[model samples]
Target: MKTLLSTIFSLLILAVPFFAQGQQTLLLVGGGQRPQEALKEWVKANPAKEPKVLIITWASANKKQAYETSIQADLREIGVRQFLFSQDITNSFEKNEFVNNLSQATHIFFSGGSQTLIMNILNSDPQLMNQLQHAYWKNNIPVAGTSAGTAVQAELMITGDTKNLEYGLGFLPKTVIDQHFFKRGREDRLRSFMKQAPGNFTGIGVDEDGSILFKRDPKTKEFNSTVLGSKNIMVIGPEINQFRQEKILRPTLLCSQLF
Candidate 1:
């Protein structure tokens, strides 16, 4: 009996690391007013007592400084002191600096602007992309993004003009994410994109002043999303019957769906 109990304890100890690795966290905010509550929730996701945040404003062109200032104010309001910003990839030196910052960050954030521009820059550099992936995936750092930042988290990015589609950072697999969802009247646009999107990808449309926290379960290895803030998050999936005239199906899930 003593040997059997010892073997059970050893097996449980071996499972600890695998279980912790399966849990990944993402905080995606829709464009507009970022509620203090949402930012606080993001802070809580970090395991460190005082997380060092690295804000990447690659999506914004000339407004990078302005975006950083606003986000810095918010972070300070939440009692986050160790925060830094980086943007504008003009030379190899700047790109390398950004990659190095990724390694140091306990939590990484992306600010709002143009998703097209964000992907354009990320796609240009293989090293930068790999490092960002390593920081979030292998290192298990929590990632947060707002607006265009949120849109780039998915594999299929919905450009403001739904007619044109582009590849994103692919952080969220088999999903298409759109921001400023209902405020911009993008329901039809998202549906149209979902209908045309290959492989029956899921569509997540986030309204203004709202956010979704996606947490991957260790036991099931599936993501459970929790809605936060004042607005709604619309999730669209494929219809059960492929032969049906309407291939896209929008479920009745709303803010009530919890993690």
Candidate 2:
């Protein structure tokens, strides 16, 4: 009986990777993103692929593990073209280097930390802001956000205004995303953002080891986003069922929704 139970457990563990095949994704860990397994997959997907992806970390609040030098080192080791948003400018250099790189990047990663810190950099530099504006609209590049990094993708951020918490970047123009969703028990907070923007924007609550894929079809101008690695995403909008059909989409439901 013990042997039978052990075999069953081994099979289940082996099946984990296959189950997540639906999502071709990577993790965006913060000060500490739980689930080392997820990080391993992220490293594998981003391994030294020629064009060498770029990472623009903006959410570093405290100067602890969020140091720019450290992040650049990690990215370079993985063969990524790392550029500190705060650096890259010289008397004769282009002020929008960060922005240009953003547009040209195959994959752009937003590291975790303080969302406000990222907002500060964008606000301080107009050139960078314009470049980000361009990247969000450009379909050629893929944007990956983690933790507070994920929070900025939405049009409205559920930050604390009373204490001067950072707002959002409004790149998504759809919903506010709160990371550590289930783990942090932040579903209610995520819903708050949806409530304020009711019937309009969505609130995405993602737990660690979870991911959502946003895919666009050029010929038909239609898009289908798939979720994997964990629980299905919650779609909050007006007439949510129909609204989900309109925007909030994922791969788990792709067969039925896209067809």
Q: lDDT per model, in order?
A: 0.72, 0.49
Provide the lDDT at 17 for model 2. 16
Top candidate by TM-score: 1
Q: After superposition, how far is residue 49 of candidate 2 from its true place, in Å?
A: 6.3
Candidate 2 residue pairs that clash: 59-114, 225-250, 226-250, 226-251
lDDT of 2: 0.49
- Tell me the tens digit of each residue's lDDT in model 1 across 130-199: 7787777667788889999999998888886547667887777667888898898888888777776764
TM-score between model 2 and native: 0.63
Evaluated at residue 68, the lDDT of candidate 1 is 86
After TM-score superposition, what is the CA distance of residue 130 in candidate 1 from its true location, in Å? 0.8
Question: Which residue pairs in candidate 1 have backbone atoms (N, alpha carbon, C) closer than 3 angstroms, thus clashing?
Answer: none
lDDT of 2 by residue, 81-103 (tens): 53535333333354556656665
Candidate 2 regions exceeding 4 Å error are 1-49, 63-100, 160-167, 219-221, 239-254
Residue 67, candidate 1: C-alpha displacement in angstroms: 0.6
